[model samples]
Target chain A: MDRNIARLRNRLDGLGVSLRPHLKTAKSVEVARCVMNSPEGPAMVSTLKEAEQFAAAGVRDIIYAVGITPAKLARVAQLLEGGVDLAVILDTVEQARAVAEVSRQTGVRIPALIEIDCDGHRSGVRPTNQVQLVEIGQALAAGAELRGVLTHAGDSYRGGGAEALQHCAEVERLAVVDAARILQHAGLPCPVVSVGSTPTAHHATDLMGVTEVRAGVFVFFDLVMAGIGVCQVDDIALSVLATVIGHQREKGWIVTDGGWMALSRDRGTSKQTVDQGYGLVCDVNGTPYPDIIVADANQEHGILAARAGSNARLPDLAVGDRVRLLPNHACATAAQHGSYNVVRGSSHVVEAHWTRFGGW
Target chain B: MDRNIARLRNRLDGLGVSLRPHLKTAKSVEVARCVMNSPEGPAMVSTLKEAEQFAAAGVRDIIYAVGITPAKLARVAQLLEGGVDLAVILDTVEQARAVAEVSRQTGVRIPALIEIDCDGHRSGVRPTNQVQLVEIGQALAAGAELRGVLTHAGDSYRGGGAEALQHCAEVERLAVVDAARILQHAGLPCPVVSVGSTPTAHHATDLMGVTEVRAGVFVFFDLVMAGIGVCQVDDIALSVLATVIGHQREKGWIVTDGGWMALSRDRGTSKQTVDQGYGLVCDVNGTPYPDIIVADANQEHGILAARAGSNARLPDLAVGDRVRLLPNHACATAAQHGSYNVVRGSSHVVEAHWTRFGGW
Candidate 1:
């Protein structure tokens, strides 16, 4: 997992770019420390649990990556009281009004980022919604301080090729930039222009106006990232160490303990070209060995087999033998367990437990 | 959760079938009590954590679902010593030897279930591999007691419909029956012939030679089961209650506090006619709305909108308003959170903390 995170960081740094990594995917406190670099680096969090954990860990700056709920405002206000610099995000005028009202009541000047639609994939205001952004800006300005605009290039997870990813990055940059300008044009103080997603971060060169990038999956890259032309298969770090308990030689099936219970049921690879079955098949060293994929999985059993037509041999594998499996989706795979068994090469190293909070 | 657990038992009573429902999914002491109406109702568990906890809670009979790892054999042996009638599964000759040797060392007469390949989806000895099963059986008979043969119809999850699922179930039954017959022909007593899966259990009309069934997903039915016509959407009980956090008017997106963190990244709906995004959109009271689906999701955010061309006039939902989301896969979604925030209508009833177990 460390290698993948470093590889993405190095790749982006070589292009004179910085990544505002989301700590939500790898919720490990140890990993977050590495990402934040001791002091609070600019990071995106999916929940207040993550924000509170990172903030309490002495990280000063954070962006609650998920859109903020009005009901959660009092909690966000509580977090602000801790003296940590935080930014909440939203897209609608209704959400802005709610945040503004909460800020007025609590006397908490929590900064807010307006989510802008880039790919029409999920949440956010449309790129051409100049009037709505102005309305939201005017509303939030009346109550809370307007931070800036943020957008996630979600579509970058689909298709293939760096050119496609690069195009997505350009579009993502335009969306956030356009939304920020609209807020500024409406007399709202908009400063930060944030865009994120692993592929966009890897391919983005003309981040001239992009202030910060908020990508997450690159930290513990999965098969989805590798298959989408974002990263090489070898770049994946996080893997479930499983033991081959049994096999049916008549029909190629290897049963391992790393089922959905261990690796999660994220079928992100199903849509990719070389559908990594349940997850990308790998050797004990985390290398993707061709033709070996987890074809099916149950709650606590993964059914692996050699792919349709390849000279992939399952000869060396036997009962009690161990193998590391690269996840199809990093976030899902990481969320399955309580902690990360942080390893170094083939050595059984330290185990870092991620204390997860609940009730969003 | 309690109500649904009872519903499963009642459904089984109606079918007049005895099953050893795996407690691995619902690793709760209280839930296990609800299911153990008969002697055979002693649920199978996948982890040693469950075995220890359940055994301590007075559960005598348990089949530790996963193959007994070397490190875990001692734990299983310990549980067996605590007056818990234990049975463990093994698929390979080497695995049988490991369990037998552990049993010999610990003097824990651990019962064994030799896994047979009912469907060539995951683990087990093929029906044609009579030689291997006979070898393992003879070896185990010399060291440990051979209880029976077991097979999980895992392929039933992807078999599509009743006909397809029935075919898969037949394969499971035949594989186990064939293996049992082979052992019987060798003058070995193979008492147990087990077949299981929610699809198989619900649709099986001929459990003629099968002694036991092992279905776990029935208690907390998910959208995946509903997608394949095994269960109706109304049968689902658990849902992730989320508040509308943000919105986009033009793109028609309502952002929710519950993302994949709460809902899980199980996209079993992708193969269906309408991909139910992250989950099936439900009202605040746990009723699925017509054509309302979560279109897309990130780590901690979900986008709720219409399923397809059918325009849905989503309720006047504002930020802070709560909505329940029925998940695509129950086990996956339930695993996302630490515990279930059980509710009865609008009142908060109880919090059933799932005691999860990891490692061998």
Candidate 2:
């Protein structure tokens, strides 16, 4: 955990950019503390529920990264009133006006960031859609301060290698930075230019115009990250501890107590070169078990077999034996459990339990 | 909820089999009360945690359907000693001996069910493996009571149609009943003969030898069940309420706050006749929006789009507009939420709030 935090922090520092590590993955206060370079530094959260938890934990600066809805404004007011330096995102003029109206009604200055779509992957206003961008900026400026613009290069996940990742990183940087320039040209206070996704953040060649980068999955890299070449298989910090309960010897299946309920139903690696079935199985101490994959999962049972179509001899594991399964996506898997059974260093003993906050 | 309960109860009553409704779906005490045919009737649970919750709700007869491990015997003893008529399943002689040892040590008469693998879908000993089955029965009878055998037609999920489902159901019934016969012939008490899986239980032609039918996911039918022709789409009782947060108009994507976190990472319909993406999109009144689906999902954002490769028009949904998404698998989707914001009849008004217990 410490190494991952340091790796990202040092990289961003060298690039002369701030690290606003996304808190969505590790929703624990302890993890947030480790993620932030300083004790009381800014961090980004994906939900208001996270904003509430992180704010209460004394980490004041927060960015509710998802586009805000009017119904959530009242909750935003509570956070602001509690002295939380909260910033919200919005792309539509309707959302901007609503945020502004809520800010006006509550007499609280809600900081807003214009969400720019770098890639046609998910939600955001196109960076080049200057008319809509300026309109949104103007509307938000009425009752909310225009913090800047931000874009997540979601397509970066589809990238094959470091070359693709670097290209995506550049695209994300250019789009957010260009949006900031347009807003600045319109006389809007464009202070922050944020762009990230684990792939892009780790591979970006430059961050000259970009003020800060935001990423969540880099904290506990998973198979998806490994498949994308952002991290190696050894860097994955989270894994589901499971117990072998049964076997289908003919089919070479080892049934484990850990299923989708323990590991998540995120088939993130399915699109990659290696379609890790459910997850990659490992020994209790986190050593990768050769030729084993959690091929399928029921509500309470995981079918561990040789990765699809492989004729690898099934290990002679018996019932009551323990193993671990590394997740395809750390964010999704971490959300399954209420807390992290933390293990530091090479020890198998749980060092401390870190509580993770969930829900909206 | 009452209608779903009645539907299953009526079906089981005519089949002359008891209903051991699996509480893994609606883990609520309130739902369990409604689901139980009698106030103190038997129920099935996937985890010891659910067994603990249901037992505390005054539902006496509970079966922990998963194969038991030595580690869980202590918790099982607690449930049994607390006057909960708890029964556990085991396929191996090792597990049976462990249960017997625990029962003997605690002076708690643990009831045991031998799991028969009728279909090679998941865990259980084959019914034809008479030597092992008899050994397990003998081991359990030493310090525990052999309550009979149970089998889940897990492969019924992979069956093609009604013909296939009926065949799988028959396979489940015969394997469990044959196991019981073998045990009875071996001079071991074989009483309860359990067989089910939502697909199998609903399609079974003969329940003559079966004592009880255990099925979850039937109460809240999903797209997978609908695709298999087990239930109509209207039979689906659970849906995710989501709010339109933004849109990528050019791509025809309507972004919402319902993400994989709200909808779950269960892409269960991917292999169905109609791959419903993440889920089939619906209006607030539970009306299906033609051709629309939650095409993709991030942690807190669902990308609402036309089903893959379909040039369906993006609906004119603005920010804050509400919609509902019918899940691919109710069991997997329902696990994502902390509680059910239950609505009764045709009204949009929340009639009740039921809490669901999650975790192992």
Best by the DockQ measure: 2
Pairs that collide in candidate 1 are A40-A59
Displacement of the residue B36 alpha carbon in candidate 1, Å: 1.9
lDDT tens digits, residues B23-131, model 2? 8998889888888876665899998889988887788999998888888888999988999999999888888998899989999989999999898878888988999
The CAPRI class of candidate 1 is: medium
Interface RMSD, model 2, angstroms: 1.0
Error of 1 at A57 (Å): 1.7
- Judge candidate 2 at residue A175 and give its lDDT: 93
> Which portions of model 1 show Cα errors greater than 4 Å?
A1-19, A346-359, B1-17, B38-41, B69-71, B119-121, B126-130, B155-185, B204-211, B272-277, B309-316, B345-360
Residue B14 alpha-carbon offset, candidate 2, angstroms = 1.0
lDDT of 1 by residue, B266-297 (tens): 78888876578889887787767788888777
Q: What C-alpha RMSD does candidate 1 show over the true interface residues after superposing them?
A: 2.2
